[model samples]
Target: MMISRKLVYVASLSLGLSLLASTAMAKVEMNAMCFMKQSESTAHAFNPTKEEIADSSILKKNPTNVTDADVDAKFRIASLSKVITTDWAIAKLGPEYRFKTKIYVTPGTKAGNCNLHIEGDMDPYMGREMLTRIFTQLKPKLTAQSCKYIETFSYDQYFPVYLDAMKHQTNHDLGWEDPARYFNSTKTKNDLAAFLKVKSGLKGDFSNIGVVTKDRYQEYLKGVPSKVYSVKSRPLFMIAKDMNKYSYNYPPNVLFEKLGGAEAYKKFAADRLKLDGEDVEMYNGSGYPAMIDGKKMYNLVSCSALVHIMQDLDKTLEAYKGTRKFQMADVMAVGGPGESYSTFKGLYAGGTYDNTMVAKTGSADKAITFGGMLSTADGDMYFAVLTSPETYGGADTTKARVIIRELVQTLAERQKLKKFEYKQIGDMNATDDQSTLVEEPKQTPAGSLK
Candidate 1:
């Protein structure tokens, strides 16, 4: 009896060890790809039949058997979310739109003493250079006409400062700093006052910055300003161009919030691109991760949906009427030695791939993705590569990037697409005219500027 029991225990231990080994081997990583050749008008599926295989056919690979579901499976796309945000802005706001900041002066009891009211549109590109221009313009007007020192300053609720949200009026904190380190609005009130004093170079203590009730601000908006001046930001397309080239997180988030958040974005995606809700879960515009239900979630987008977005964006930019022509390279990072500051310059800079690709690269703790158009012999090939090392037999980011580079190189060679060339029309980092001052209409009728 004792010998039989010992044999049974040994068998059970062996089975348990076998199961553990199997589970360990199953923890491999995964990769998915979707390629759409413009000429074929079809997205290639992964590892398709030889006859069905083409540059446009949607293709993908994984540890398990590849299926159509994998093509539509949502993957956290990291900074690629900026592409979607740019698309929305181009469609809704147009390429020429510029953000505005309006200023109103209400003279105080003493001459040349005014209580200042600034209405901001949450300009995402507000930086030292832009701020310097605004203050430079303000100095002459404020010192000559209204007030040498702003007796008290108040701005709209949307001002990107740390104190405004802490007053318990907003739903959440607005102290989060953007990736550009431009405004640094997360600091305390004193920091703002000191910063403003230096930026303006005026002889006034600006520590008395105040906030008015929402009702009062609205009333002021409806009433014509007795004394007013305004500053406008660079056009929307230029802003979008810089945002993507640098992959700055703040600009897209501001634009996203201005466009009505995730729910609105979902509706837009569904209606415009026919993207299914399951494949388009965007919590924020920047593609930054969020915490929900005690779990961290990044912006999830399927490979097909992302390709479709790139296709649509290209078309939209092509058709847009503007002073100067716009192309995908204008709004996306170009892969070449020409654009020294672009995020993808280093990766695709060799002579063979140089300037032939305009792409966006996204990375997260678990996800490394690349998506955009590849100029090909057949036509422009829109593609998305989503990779993660968390799945079964997964590889780290470095290995995944190497694999992708080789894959892209192979595809280019197979299709005879390496001959395509993209000559940048102007310097990507060229600055627009900053001195052009757009004065708001002296009399803005009731609710017109709102």
Candidate 2:
């Protein structure tokens, strides 16, 4: 009996030791690094600096251990994909670009009827608020013009669906639908009716919403013997600011699709940054898990690559042709007291990071990533951190964030950190659609000072 008991104790002790060994070996894999602008250069040139606690295996192409990776190692960068998407938008579209929707109206041969043609520019943010404002303006004009009923309403499919979705608060997942076939003509007509009934204050039914293609619309435009009214969306930077502030998945994907989708962005990065294909792979702008060819794809980027991209984006923002100078926070969420609804609200709030960090954060089932600029007295320091745990969930995200907080603390301790000079735009949900009537610019005074 004593010998049997001794054998059982020995087995239990061995099993415990084995478990401990495995637990010790299973560390979180990560790659975190930063780059600071050279102090003396007029052109902001970055000097790469290592400030991470990672495993040595991180340098290898396929990292076995999770702990030690260098800046060059690749990892899934979740919401950080928004940062890259914003970079592409600013480069391709410029800062002042606005999505415009053209409205053409021709008085019908009969009384109290008019044909309305709306050409949508695929403006992603054309939601309920914008439509309401648009209709409010249109209603007064149409009433003054003596048109009671819209005899023939012609428009692209997306505009009506956007109107319906925004009015009903049903556009929760904007990226999942095929834009070309999202809504039928019948549904679009009904949606337009519902919208006009509630918001437009127009009398009589608006029948027949023709879902016309762009080519067909161009032909129609040539036949129209009347003026065109245009409504312009808010500038791209403001739209991007709200997108990153809340880390909404829809806007980035919409803007990305407009810029030519994920593959195009991958090629853009490769061409512009001279990055190796192995270093960066973007499946979507939102960094959401998507299946292509029956395989799940995620955005993967090296810390070094992300930091370099940030440097590029910053330079672009500084040179933006806007009335006010733009900074990283103009398009990226900033950490602070006022940014209560931003992505960094809970994670980076308080004196340590308040108004000092402008970044994008990403979290998935097994990945947690963050990258952005940290304002310091030395100069702006850009960083990217990617983490993959053995098992990750909501709790794991918290743990990863705690680690990130500590890392930021360590970095802050080393530098004379200062607050970034930018103000938050507050909550995204409360924001109104700031679209405006596109009017011809007034001529400047002959002797106006330049």
Taking all chains together, each candidate's TM-score versus the true structure is: 0.78, 0.75
- lDDT of prediction 1: 0.63
Q: Roughly what TM-score does model 2 have, to 2 decimal places?
A: 0.75
45: Cα error in model 2, Å: 18
Q: Which stretches of candidate 1 lie over 4 Å from their true place?
A: 1-28, 39-42, 47-66, 161-191, 210-215, 221-225, 292-295, 348-351, 391-395, 418-435, 444-450
Candidate 1 structure quality by residue, lDDT tens digits, 1-450: 011223322533233234334444333244577788765545664443443233211122222244577778888788889999999989888888877777776655566676667777767755455556666777777666747666777776555532232211122122223332333444424444655777666665576776564468768656543467777777787677766766666678778877888889989998888887777989877776766687777898888888888888888887988787777877887765566455455333232345567887776767777787877656778888777756312334544454444445444544544434456543222124643445555664543221
Global CA lDDT computed for model 2: 0.63
Error of 1 at 244 (Å): 1.8
